[model samples]
Target: MRTVDQKLRDRRRRHILTAAISCFIRDGFHRASMQEICKEAGMSPGNLYRYFDSKEAIIEAIAEDERKENATYYAKLFRAKNFLKSLGKMLGASLKKASDPNYERIALEVAAEASRNPKVAAMFAQNEAETKASLVLALRDAAARGEIDGQLDFEAVATILIAVADGAIGRMSLDPALRTTALMPTMKIMITRFLRPPDGP
Candidate 1:
């Protein structure tokens, strides 16, 4: 099922992506060039080009990888016994992940760059739409089970939830002292109260 050639290709691809991320974090996505990525990866331009010819390609790859990772989390949510609590924990984890400076800087810069690049803008928009769809599905399912309030529009709730998480990320990005541990308890309380069933909980 495995071949040395395929393994080597995967390793090279990972190496290139890692180097690209470092270049983006250090010099920024807008300023980081292919040559810088090649230098960072310790590979010739030709060699690196074979794996990924453009920074946009690397960003697309990163988006795809994150999409797969988020899919796993959404899948796990379906099996969670305490839906609202699990949802709170997932949001807390997301906030912590998104608050990392290295991640935030690169992600924000990429978002900025995407505004000027149609290809990247389309790719990013699709990724955001897919994530929102997954969230709406999960929220609707929770409501159907009578865990969350079924009266509220799942689409609007998902949008607000994502916006809240994004706001936390932006605020924490500016103020590193706003620790996740401190914010999470209040967030958890807010989530539980917002989604909890009236007669059941």
Candidate 2:
């Protein structure tokens, strides 16, 4: 159970994170300032610094939170026995959010910064590795359930699926036009192909 002070601190931290993400999206990481972040968060500069020592710290926290959320999202599918059902639910959840124009715009900005910022890049890489490990474990479960054959290379296949999903989301975030046709279909095909049982091999 959290005390009132702890809850308030958590709320403030959340506000700071949301403000930092908005500022980073609007101004890019290099240009976003602590002063601007404070204004966006509706807190004084002194107060903001109490929550986060610097803009980089805030960005790191955001990345860590995003990574944790990603892991948690996939953990649900890993727990499920119904392969196609879990796949569809996951795809639908992702597509619904990514399809939103505002979310897509912010995600694109984050991706651009991720390419140049060493910390952000490393964080994303670590996040990807964790996600892939979770996926491989899930695939192994699917294989054991007879939904997928055991002979298939689970790690390799999980890597390919992760790559495909990342590629689709990255492309969609950059070009909204692609979402209309290729994005969802590519995702569907990947899930279908990956889950399909081997033809007596």
Candidate 3:
């Protein structure tokens, strides 16, 4: 149980994080300043500092929120009765989210930065591991239910699926003009091959 004061503080902290994410999405992480974030959050510098020690802390908060959201999505996916249908929906949802220009810009930029910054890289690695675990669970369930071949390696297959999805999103970010018709067929072929059973119909 949380006290009212504690709840209020949590709410304010979430608000500040939301504002910071919006600012970071609109302006690259390197360009977005604490002052701008404070202004967007409707909090003074002192108040913002009460919630986050620094801009880096705010960025981490934003990244953590995204990680949690992805986890929740995977949870829902695991709960789905028809694994194939759920997988399709999950891929569609991810593609739609990635299509958002703001999300694309910030996510791609942060990922690149993480490659160069030890702190950011550590955070990203932690998030990636958690996400991979969730994926492995989902893939295992799918295999148990016969949606995927039982003999295949769940963790490795999950890794490949995640990599393909990430690559699709990255490619879309690079060339928004490419028709989904052109790319989705390639994806469908790969997925169909993976999901196909050994025995003939």
Candidate 4:
């Protein structure tokens, strides 16, 4: 059990992260200053600094939080009766959230920053690698249970799936008119087709 002091500490850190995310989304990461984050968080510079020393630190914290979320999502996928369906629905929900202007801005900004910053790149890469590994491992287990195609190359397929999802997110962010309802059923069909065993090879 967390003590009161510990809970307060966690809450303050979360507050700082939330403020940093808003500032980063409003102004690009490079332009979002520590002062702005402090003001947005309603904390003094010295107080905010006690939680996060830099924007990079805050971003890293966010990445860590995302990884934990991904883990929970995967655990839920494994618990589902249909792994492929659960995966599709989960990713569909994610894409739908990405369509929101705030989510889109933050996702695009983080992806853009990852491209230019080695540390940020590693943060995302690690997350992706863990997700991909979980996907492949889960698919392999599903195959053993005769739930999916046992003969398929799961590693290759996982890569393609992740790439497609990332591309969809990018497109969703760039095209405000895009509809998640329009995309999800097709995504479900694609996942089923890709993972299900055909009569022949």
Candidate 5:
């Protein structure tokens, strides 16, 4: 029940976001002007403005897109039968994404922006809360199934997991030589040993 105009609008919006990301990655977020994004997007200022009033609006849209992606990923993790295995796979996938130079740059930019912009902070904070909650629920289910230690503090563990990912992102950004694929096996062993039930064989 979608109109052609609506579909076209959506496509245009995505196009603008893709162009904006490239600009933002090439230059820091503060240096990436709307005019530059317009040029990158192959659109006039008036047309780009119709889609996004300002850089902040574009950033908000990007955050929303990321939130949706995280939601979908966490939903799948919650439904997974093997929680530990699923969590390991999720972490591995996240590390792989963080290894991408563009993704790392964007992530660092967003984190810096969140510190300076209250609205950006709140948006990412909400996403973080939802992600942690989903992880906690998944962990609880895993405990119930005797897959992990029931006595473990799920909230703290969830926080640690997120922190580890953030740390990995930071490290990869700083050290180009650090390979996520090479580190994944060690990461898997650490997560397995940390979460597995005490009596687990």
Candidate 6:
């Protein structure tokens, strides 16, 4: 059902984005130039322009990719059997991702860019809202199954979880030497105690 030309186009777009990410990571988003990105992609400006018109376009594409990735992750999480355990694993995986220097740097840069760019802010906000909603639903389901406290406010708990993730990412950015794996045990214990229903096994 797919044509060769379409496949090639998709490949080229991915190449461009890969190059752009490297450039953005090396030289913050604002400083990364289209020319530099073209060089990194091993393409001329004329060719690269065919895929993305400007830096903002590239940023938008990256944000869209992130949104889709998050959706896929949440979909899998929702299907998981043990909600609290799955949530803990998800948090740990997220912390591991944040521990990557390049990822941490890019995340920080995106956060900074979002503050000044309304479009970027809106894009990230939508992703945040969607992720939080999914988390709230997961919390409610877990409660119904007696995995967590039934009386706890799922919405507030979801928000706090998101905040905790953001804080972890921010902390990683600030301390490159910090190892997320070392912190997991403590994090898991805290989450389990906070969510486990009273008198739970």
Candidate 2 overall Cα lDDT vs. reference?
Answer: 0.76
Residues 12-65 of candidate 5 have per-residue lDDT tens digits of 999999999999999988789999999999999999999999999999999899
- Per-model CA lDDT versus the true structure: 0.86, 0.76, 0.79, 0.87, 0.90, 0.88
Error of 1 at 188 (Å): 0.7
Ranking by lDDT: 5, 6, 4, 1, 3, 2
TM-score of each: 0.94, 0.84, 0.84, 0.93, 0.94, 0.92
| Candidate 2, superposed: residue stretches over 4 Å from native | 174-186
Cα displacement (Å) at residue 132, model 6: 0.8
Question: Over the stretch 1-201, how does candidate 3's per-residue lDDT look in tens digits?
Answer: 469989999899899977987887788777889999999998899988988988779778877887989888898888998666677667767776777667777787788778878898898889888888998888888777777777888788778878877877888878988544466556766776777556622
Top lDDT model: 5
- What does candidate 2's lDDT look like per residue over 16-92, in tens digits? 99888788778877788899988898889878889899866886787788788877778898788787668766766
lDDT of 6 at 134: 85
Candidate 2 residue 185 Cα shift, in angstroms, is 6.3
Candidate 5 structure, TM-score to reference? 0.94
Candidate 4 local lDDT, residue 87: 84
Per-residue lDDT value at 80 in model 2: 82
Per-residue lDDT of 1-201 in model 6, one digit per residue for the tens? 469889999999999999999999999998999999999999999999999999989988988898888788788778889877888899998888778788878888888999999988898888889888988888888888888999998889999988998798888777778889988998888899999999897
Candidate 6, superposed: residue stretches over 4 Å from native: 1-3
| Top-TM-score structure, candidate number | 1
Q: How close is candidate 2 to the true structure, as a TM-score?
A: 0.84
What value does the lDDT take at residue 165 in candidate 5? Answer: 82
Position 14, candidate 6: lDDT: 98
Backbone clashes per model, in order? 0, 0, 0, 0, 0, 0
Give the 10-residue window scoring lowest on summed lDDT in candidate 3.
178-187
Better of 1 and 5 by TM-score: 1
- Candidate 1 lDDT, tens digit per residue, 1-201? 469889999988988888899999998898999999999999999898898878888999988888888888888888898788888888988888987888888788889889889998888788888888999999888889899888888888888888888888888878988887889989888888877777767
Candidate 4 clashing pairs, residues 3+ apart or interchain = none
